[model samples]
Target: MDEMTCPKCGSSMTSRTLGAVTVNRCPSCSGVFLDRADLADLVEAENDWHRHTGPLTEPLPRITADMTAPPPSRPKARSYIETLFD
Candidate 1:
């Protein structure tokens, strides 16, 4: 294991290797440490997992017409016979 200083607090960080990548974490600040390669690998894995699982689904809310508005003041439309006479 390699040792590094925390950038935020300058505290000693502990290093550990998981698989092929190395990670460092600060005990005092509870911060995670990762190299550029480690972050890229993590992002790629996350994207792949999301692709296989498909997109997430969300429920839509139901809508109803309002009944409180006043009715139309104009008269209803005339039939074809009534219109021919007029």
Candidate 2:
């Protein structure tokens, strides 16, 4: 299973809502990962304590087999829904 692990520290992160933004925040480091879609809101939010490490315009790309493992010997077929979703 995929875990929302913090990059700054190896702590397990929890979801938090700052105004209208939902992000993964590390309690140990007080660092948060913002959803790209929510960044505009983050900028306009009333709070002024937040700082971002880098651009948070989008969430991390989903890790597929191509990223984590060697390619298969042959191409695998995609499901109907997978095709539609992709």
Candidate 3:
């Protein structure tokens, strides 16, 4: 197939194949061109991945006030020379 030009930026697009699907991506603008078939294939692949990795059983820990609080600043230790002067 001929190399595609990005419709958004008019930049030269590179062809990348994921499994049997071929997608045109613009290096300049990071835009991807996907037809219906390509989109369907990608969606199917994502569904398969989700199916293999089961949903999380436990809820993730929520951020609390303590967790968000800034850590207490410690006093700077005096250097050996400063201590000798003291």
Candidate 4:
């Protein structure tokens, strides 16, 4: 395993392999330490994994404008039967 130092805090970093890509993570700062090329490689590997896993599940449908439109407003109501009782 290669040794790497954290760029932010200068703390020693540990190497880890997530999925198929290798990354260096900082211990003290809890920050991921990866070079530009390593970051790109990690993203590419993740995308490749997703591609092989097939398409993701469809997202839930969102409320449309028609569904969200407010109902028609009406004037104050008066009951004829109530008026007769009164």
Indicate the TM-score of model 3.
Answer: 0.60
lDDT value, candidate 3, whole model: 0.69
List residue ranges in candidate 4 displaced over 4 A: 18-20, 55-86
Better of 2 and 3 by lDDT: 3
lDDT (tens digit, per residue) of candidate 3 on 1-86? 77689999999998767676777778899887879998887777766665666545998678876776568996542331122112
Candidate 2 error regions (>4 Å): 47-86
Q: What clash count does candidate 1 reach?
A: 0
Give TM-scores for every candidate, taking all chains together and pairing residue i with residue i.
0.49, 0.42, 0.60, 0.48
Ten-residue segment with the worst summed lDDT in candidate 2?
77-86
Error of 3 at 45 (Å): 0.8
* Local distance difference test values of all predictions, in order: 0.65, 0.60, 0.69, 0.62
Per-candidate Cα RMSD to the true structure, in Å, reads: 24.6, 17.7, 19.4, 23.1
Clashing pairs in 2: 36-57
From the highest lDDT down, the ranking of the candidates is 3, 1, 4, 2
Q: Which residue runs does candidate 1 get wrong by more than 4 Å?
A: 54-86
Better of 2 and 3 by TM-score: 3
